[model samples]
Target: MQQYRNKLLGKGCCGTSYTQVTEELQELIFNHVNREHDRVNEHRGSETNPEELQELIFNHVKKDISQSEENRGNLRMTSGSRALEKHKLPSFKNLIDLIIDDTVFNNNFLQMMGGMTSLQSIEIFSSDISVNNTLFDQGICKMLHLQHLEIWANGLMGTLPWCLANLTSLQVLDISYNDFMGNISLSPLKMLTSVQELRLSDNHFHILVSLEPFFNHSKLKNFYGPLPIQPHMSLKELDISINSFHGHIPTEFGAYLPMLQTLNISRNALNGSIPSLFGDMKSLVFLDLSNNLLTRGIPEYLATDCTLLQFLVLSNNSLQGQIFLTNFNLKNFLYLQLDGNHFLRKMPDSLSNYSLEGLYISDDHLVGTLPRWLGNKSCLIDIIMSKSHLEGPIPLGFCQLESLEVLDFSENNIIGSLPSCFPPSSIKQVHLSKNKLQGQLSDGLSNISSLTTLDIGYNHFESNIPDWIDMLSNLTCLILSNNDFQGEMSIRLRKLSQLRLIDLSHNKLFGHIPPCLNITIVTTAFDFVFDSHLVRIIPLREEESVEFTTKTISYSYRGRLLAYMYGIDLSNNKLVGVIPYQIGNLVGIHSLNLSHNNLTRPIPLTFSNLKQIESLDLSYNNLNRKIHSQLVEL
Candidate 1:
């Protein structure tokens, strides 16, 4: 009967209140309770033995025989979308639980909820909900019996109500992952002494700090938001990153959150030195303060006191000074990010003691040779030191690291050929661009079939582009431009069918464009969907940007833009002869640049088929012909 009522509600019950609740429905509920009582009464008058009569009475008493609906409630359920489609004001007449799951709710449903004074718990995780005003007006403040109320991942708009203090019996109130607006306040919280857990995370609320009252309150089961109050001693984690929070961290914050194990306040507008009071916090395992305007050196306490630290990210700040002076006590650390800072120092030998898995210290003013102890850190995976001052030979000991994945030393003065022994099969992306590297790579390079991106552009390598590169069949991006490689373009390049972005510009390669250069993958800038905000807007792996030329201009592609970008650049190379008609096979390629060559021929008439071409450059070449008319269709 409840299921039948639900289907009826989905079909017709847009918004019906308790006053307007169908009399039939109300009668049905009352009859259920009355019938049970009548059955027990009739059993008492029957010709049954004492034991049978007592059994009938006992079963009725345990079943719907309580004094009220609140006492009769017992079930707790977790249902998916099927349980709640397009209904409003479905009744849980027992008043101990509400019929809640998802979708729109009108004033009638909220008014109905508020009228249920005996209702003890209600969880509403709806979609596209718009609670345009505070909950107080909805009369939820009247639910004095509610002990737990959760509204997670709902598009709940509007501010919370001070009348929430009326839920004196409320023990847990989780309203996280909603579009809740306005300042988070304790005006209502101060009176709700029974609230054991109040989760207000993943909401867009303004900041105001007045949490000193909760210092010793002991009821906090973890609080998160942009509240910059002194942390409570029991709080374990605080991740208020990716907000518009400004100003310095609370001076005595560490003193309050002494027991916190995780703290991520990154991507805010915080400035000034990291709090020295952090020395008081020794239990920290994860601390990320990156992408802020923070200045001054890292707190010395992080190196000396927080030995339990596992991940420390302080990137994209104006912080200066060496990371540590001497005794670095972070032996348990696994990942460290200090990029885009002014830490003008050498690679600290103290780092070798920790079995770190990731080290990103790029775009700094550091000076040193590749540390030999890198081989000792068997867990090492990524090592990005691009645009630094580090200079020297590729350390042969690096070859010993079995877990190496990304090795980027681009824009540094690191010289010498790849050591014959320095080829880790696990390597995926290698960016040594704009360096002084020259000479032969080890034969072991042929085995790295997993290599996806290899950008060694603007280097001093001179030779035939190695046909051995063809062995990396999975190569997606191959940028070897601005090198003195004198040869006909490797015919083997035709084998790299997965090649999406290839830049052999400013090289000495002389030959006809590879006629079979039919690259796969097609997308256009105009219609390129920026994978919705629910998209991986920012990848977990630090922002990896790639520079590619399109529309005869260099553009930096990051995030999803990089994922959908496809182009080709072979300009300024000594290539010759007619452009291949097979170039038309690249119907979805976004850019094509073959300028500054002595090629004398008409543009490929087949190019009219390119529906996704965003850029087409054929300057400084001896091409002669009218453009294909169908090309205008793009």
Candidate 2:
């Protein structure tokens, strides 16, 4: 077998390659030439172009060039190099950077790459194979010259193998999203005196407390996870967002890490009142104390002194008392998420010329009408006020929000007809479920051809299912359940092939189960989640969610896993006729509920094709011989 080796560069020239007397080995490799990566902007930052077709390696690197379906010339670090022999290649060492991106290869090359002493950067992104423990113990630990190492989202499991004590030359280390479990300590990481940026987010590591270990190493700049309270002068961004951090947030945070521009201590077990000293950190840009056990009111200084603060997320906390006081500056504030709190306020009032973009204060016991000041927020994109006690009609002034995309007033006491002028043209998801709103939905949602989710369920809206409903070509979810609606299943729903979840259940309707309801959005990648439409975040924003009752319980589905959930709930309605055989065409469906409807026919045997079905509810229907034997197998 021919061996693949790295061809290192020396100060703008080709440094060395092994050809004359090296061992004959066969391995897929990226042949990067000196000063040529800039020509291909697609591979601009990477040291080697990942899409190596049949490109020939430099003179001393390789004589024979080959290509195949699996490798694609990616550097595969499989274990046990070819049997050593003379006159072939001695010990080829000069692999500088190894970037294994979306390539089918085992991660056993670490120890092998250790021979290539010149290896500096190793990035393995979007990997599919299991990374074994020898990855650190044999390969990376020996590379004292390696500087940047990133193994993001590669599905690596188990506790971190922290043999990285001698790499003093390392500057950047990112092992985020690896799902590595750990009571991992950063005490060993402090040895890398030259490290600047360390990202440990989305891992399962319970890291060390107190930024005390790195307090002495003056160059650390961006730290992602593992929260500790300590003073580090040069540290600009300190993140302790995902961990088992307990106890109260020390009030001296402002004095400690005085240069911190962004602080994220969310998703922890810490409880206490908001620290008053945070306002003293004059350079603060983003502050996320959300998803904590934090309680009590906001400190006055945080509203007045933290002038540079733009994004504030205190969601899922027990924070109470009045919110968004007049002292709160609105100049640079972009997104404010105070959801899951008990703030006893109606809405933020002392705002006139605000530039807020996304305002989410759901479940805050907010009462009264949505303030008229809301009309001035021209930059508004998401307005979430679900599960509140807001009353009266949606203000006519809401039409002024020309940039509105998500208007979720779900689970509120808001009544009165939706004004024909409401639902601006830019709306994508208008969830007015669980309200007393009454109106012909068509009169309001007529012009919105771009709407994707129209959930007006659990309201008093009454009208025939309009033909224009099918005109919503991009509709992914159409939930009109538990509403007063009389219509035949006459609309052409099959035209909405992009539909993933449909719930017209518990309403007044009569017709055959639309064979077209089985119009499958199923594809090879139907499970892929769409890109989050919320532009700015606490690095946070709500994604689309749908509530469907299945197996006698309502479940709300959202986020990444929700992508694979295909459900159709047409139960509890006045419907009649044979269950269409084509309904079984929804082979990708996970939940199919057709109970509580007045129909008569044998259960379709074609349902046996629903291999992905998780819940099949066909109760209370007048139908059927025994269930299909194949479906019983499911």
Q: What is the TM-score of each candidate against the true structure?
A: 0.75, 0.79
Of the candidates shown, which would achieve the greatest TM-score relative to the real structure?
2
RMSD to the true structure for each prediction, in A, is: 12.2, 8.7
How well is each residue in 72-173 modelled by candidate 2, as lDDT tens digits? 232232223322232222234655566654433444444454565666877766555445565777677788888988877668788766577778889988
lDDT for each residue of candidate 1 in 1-634, tens digit (9 for 90 to 100): 3554455455533322111123223211111122233221111111221111100001001222223333223211111111111223234444554434434444544555555666677665543344544345565677788898776766776677778878888877877777777755544665777776666666777675756645544766555566656557677766676678788887888887798887878888988889988867799988889999999898887688888988889999999988886886876889989999999888888888788999999989999887788877779898888889888888888888789898888889898988886668998888888889987546777889998888888888787878787898988788888888888987888888777789999988998877777465542233443322242122325756677878767787765677777888999988999988888877778888998998886877788887777888889998885666765575
Candidate 2 stretches with Cα past 4 Å from truth are: 1-96, 101-108, 125-138, 141-145, 152-166, 176-188, 200-209, 522-525, 529-538, 624-634
Error of 2 at 1 (Å): 32
Error of 2 at 312 (Å): 0.6
Clash count of each predicted structure? 0, 14
Candidate 2, lDDT over the whole model: 0.71
Query: How much does candidate 2 score in TM-score?
Result: 0.79
- Model 1 ranges off by over 4 Å: 1-127, 130-155, 161-179, 186-204, 213-217, 523-540, 632-634
